[model samples]
Target: MPKESSQRGPTADRLHRVVVIVDENSNPFELGCTTEVFGLRRPELGRELYDFRLCSPAPLTSMRDGFFTLTGVAGLEAADSADTLIVPNRPDVEVPRRPAVLDAVRRAHARGARLVGLCSGAFTLAEAGVLDGRRATAHWQWADAFRSRFPAVRLEPDVLFVDDGDILTAAGSSAALDLGLHLVRRDHGAEVANSVSRRLVFAAHRDGGQRQFVERPLPDLPDESLGPVLAWAQERLDAPLTVADLAARAAVSPATLHRRFRAQLGTTPLAWLRGERMALACRLIERGESRMDVVARRSGLGTAANLRLAMRRERGVSPSAYRRRFGPRVA
Candidate 1:
């Protein structure tokens, strides 16, 4: 299936109604992240982009960790009418889902509503059979269990999230925020998503392929990790940076740097640098940089042709098209 953007046309042209399903022992943090992304009104935009609701099989339910209880929750019918349906983290993947909840999810998907699974919520999606034969992700801690339960699903355990057409799945709690911001970007555009990210004081976009938290057997000391090196590199994204340059800065051999990157960031140095450069290009484009050559130069992509290639490879759109869709409005 094609992405929602291609199927529905530009999301900015229509209102997006989102419904989140909650159940007893649902993680409040995941729910909060969903609400923060879709529920909040962006009066600055002069109009609301999302109509958000929280629905449940029961009217009242206890939140996970037993800290609070949610009230006034709507029924499963709310999900049927939404343009998007979100499932927050469930208490356990090993347990069976309620048949009514599963049916509601299947019905929503059958009606062409986009589906999201935040953290363990992928279990719910898989149980509903919405994720069969689709690429999905969940918390790494449950990767084995998830794979064991659903062999038909292609589970990418390392990625922060997977946006598989109408079905989207996030890895864990924080990744839920990543997926939320991504949905905003896919719908409204990068400019709006960046504004929302700024309001939340969060990074507007994180590559969904980022590895989950890795446990280093020999953890680097505070000042010994690649933190300072990465910061230095970020400050000079416009400069030609190579693996050797990064290795020299970190005072380690290229081989050691590679190991560190894999151990810590779960990607190669060049791959990480390309991702950063692409991000800078996006920011420049969003700021209304009209000249492709200038945008490429400033973003360290070097040339207009290179910029076009990178944009097409990374974003699936050309520079002009991306700018037209996401650039700031000019008076």
Candidate 2:
């Protein structure tokens, strides 16, 4: 989807409404993910991005594994007014979702509101029949069960998340944050998403296609974290950086660096670098940089043609089209 500007200082009705359904046995982690991503006040942006709220079928809801009892939120009708409705996650995937919850999801989809499923929340979506013939993901541990239960749904079980136009799904716990940040990036542009990510101290961009897990044995020697190298590369994205350069900076061979990147970030170094450059390009575009060549140069994409290719390849839109969608408005 093309990026959309977070209309700064918009009226109440203009703000995007994000409502989360806190169902019985729902997980709190994803609830916190939604709250942190869409519900919080962005004083840093000098505005709030969404008119966020929580809703439930009943006044008292039990959290996953009996963590706690949640109460005093809006009713399920709150979801009807939402621009995005986040379905709840529960650990027990075998158990069926409430009929009312499924109906709410169906209605939300019928009304053209965005639907999100985090972790086992995919089960809710599948149970609701909205995921039929749709690409979706759930925690890898339940891949067999999900495939067995929803034979019609295209389940991409290994990735972190799947964004199928109006509907999105994330695999497992931490991926909820990945999908949430993705939504922010989709709705408000890269700069705003990065700001929110920095505030949360989380990685701003994790490709939804990245693997959910890496099965690597523990290192015999002391583990060399990739944090410093990644930070260094991010600070100098405009420079001509190669795998050798990154390996040299990290005091490791290119092969070793590749393994570490896969284990830690679940993506290749080059892929990560390209993603960062594209994000920088988006930020530049969003800041009203009119010249495509300038955006390409500063973002280390080399040329305007390469910029357009990258934008179209990764963002599914041309640079000019993205700029038109998300660029600053004239007073």
Candidate 3:
């Protein structure tokens, strides 16, 4: 378990009303993610943090997986009074959204309600035009199609999620849970979010901009794949590892290592190494380590200057700022 932060405080005073918009053939896992985060009662707090409601275009709807049907759902008008409006994954993104749904989403944003999209639900937000000129993300599988349809939105497909202030967009099914916990962390502080995470058996916080876990096609010959070599490199992140070193560890020539890395990880050896080092630095920062030099050395990033440059280039934030947002706070 991680240490509790001392800077815990309510982000807002009043109970927040959250409304989830369900469309026909909605994804149950996405809806359940929202419900699990906002709908549950937290007696530990002595008061509810969110008043969660489910509203759909219709009162009854069947889910996409065809295993469950939802009933007692409120109409679109229910969203009119919500503090946050969430859209879960739909059956398709290419299909046009209902005008009524678009209008409600636009109106909610115009009235200052926070808007969220889980997975392909980002398509609906894009259709509503609320995502225009804003940074957002969706499941990586739909990256090309999403870009083709909505060229105006700056889509970052690699990320777990994107929090562009009032509009939050999550990448895929599991990313929805990350975004949901993020909302809790944003509204009720880390202590409460961590408590909720423990109950849910989920990671309390994953930086939204962290890269998605992409699946790669591996070679049939296990020896040809670089999995073991990658693991070895990970264990030696603090060491001055090189392409030649990696090649030696894998018992392959540097040229062969390059080919295998491209085929397996879709990146160069040095680039992948940098990404791993940056990820390690982020974890160290989140754990409340304040010494930049120590963090850089531990992560094999070399110096405080290099860490700052890498963080800025990759994560768009300074080390101190990242720590302030994620590190354990002292009283």
Candidate 4:
């Protein structure tokens, strides 16, 4: 997570600052995603997670197709104070972004602030030249045009999003919510992220590498939604569940289950189960589970060594380090 900028002023002791750069012709859906995920006060969690605001090059920015006019937002100078700066999301990729907006993105990157480009917002980041040689993803429909316009960017057209350290990009409008929840999870831990997801009525975690578009958009069978099986497995995380167990629960063969998982979740059954276990482990740690054996056993990870390895691989940090960062602390 990026540190809050010194420009936070009296709110310096508050949560991380998130500023959205709303340009002319911006997509309202992605803008709503940022607001729903990061702007709302989380009274359920006893406090808010982010100090969120919106900024634009002008006071009255017109949304895509003139559906609405957004007004009363801060000016471009607000971008310098953002810990995470979200670039403009515009469908008209052919039009050039405001030079001020591009400069704000570049300044944010130079200051080590986290940068986010949702959907066609990648075009703005690319135009700023900050995304040169960096892995990014835009809306699949614009993939070819993006590549042609910016050959320097390593475009991952198929993935839902790409998290390249301080910079993140989502492929489509809906994927912006996925990336927002991911940012929360990375900064505040899984428990907090899950709370935010429940409020938004969204899946807590969708792996960034998941395909933006599933070939089978809907399940062929009415019972193949995977929701029931996933809930059952989550309830039994302490049990040694396998793919066969999941298949049996779903009343399908192993191969059928594999295909269904791929179609519905864009991931294998084993990977999803493992990810759930890791998430459980993270939640346990965040809640002050000091004993490694207890956390491992409760999360169905088997042993301390397995927990350590899994934490390192998935979080890029050891279990102890994770605890220090998110665990309950003494006053």
Question: Tens digits of per-residue lDDT for model 4 on 1-331?
Answer: 3233333211436678999999999999999999999899888998778889999999899899999999999999999989889999888899998888888999998887888899998999999998888899999999999999999999999999998877889997779999999988888889889999999998889999898988564546465578899999999999999999999999999999999898888999999989999999999999988999999999999999999999999987899999987788769
RMSD of each: 2.7, 3.1, 6.6, 2.8
**Candidates' C-alpha lDDT:** 0.85, 0.88, 0.82, 0.89
Clashes of each: 0, 0, 0, 0
Q: Candidate 2 vs candidate 3: which has greater lDDT?
A: 2
Q: Better model by lDDT, 1 or 2?
A: 2
Q: Each model's TM-score, in the order given?
A: 0.88, 0.91, 0.67, 0.93
Order the candidates by TM-score, highest first: 4, 2, 1, 3
lDDT of 1 by residue, 179-243 (tens): 99988887776778888899889977777888877547464554447788999999998888899
Model 3 lDDT per residue over 1-331, tens place: 1112222223445568889998788888898899899999988766687888999888778888677788888988998978888975786778788889999999988787888899998999999988889889999889999999999999999989988878889987789999998888766545667778998998666667666774455557455767688889999899999999999998989998887776655567888888778878877887778999999999999999999999988655799977877677679
Candidate 2 positional error at 38, Å: 1.1
lDDT of 2 by residue, 228-288 (tens): 9999999999999999999999999999999999988889999999999999999999999
Q: lDDT of candidate 4 vs native? A: 0.89
2 against 4, candidate with superior lDDT: 4
Error of 1 at 133 (Å): 1.2
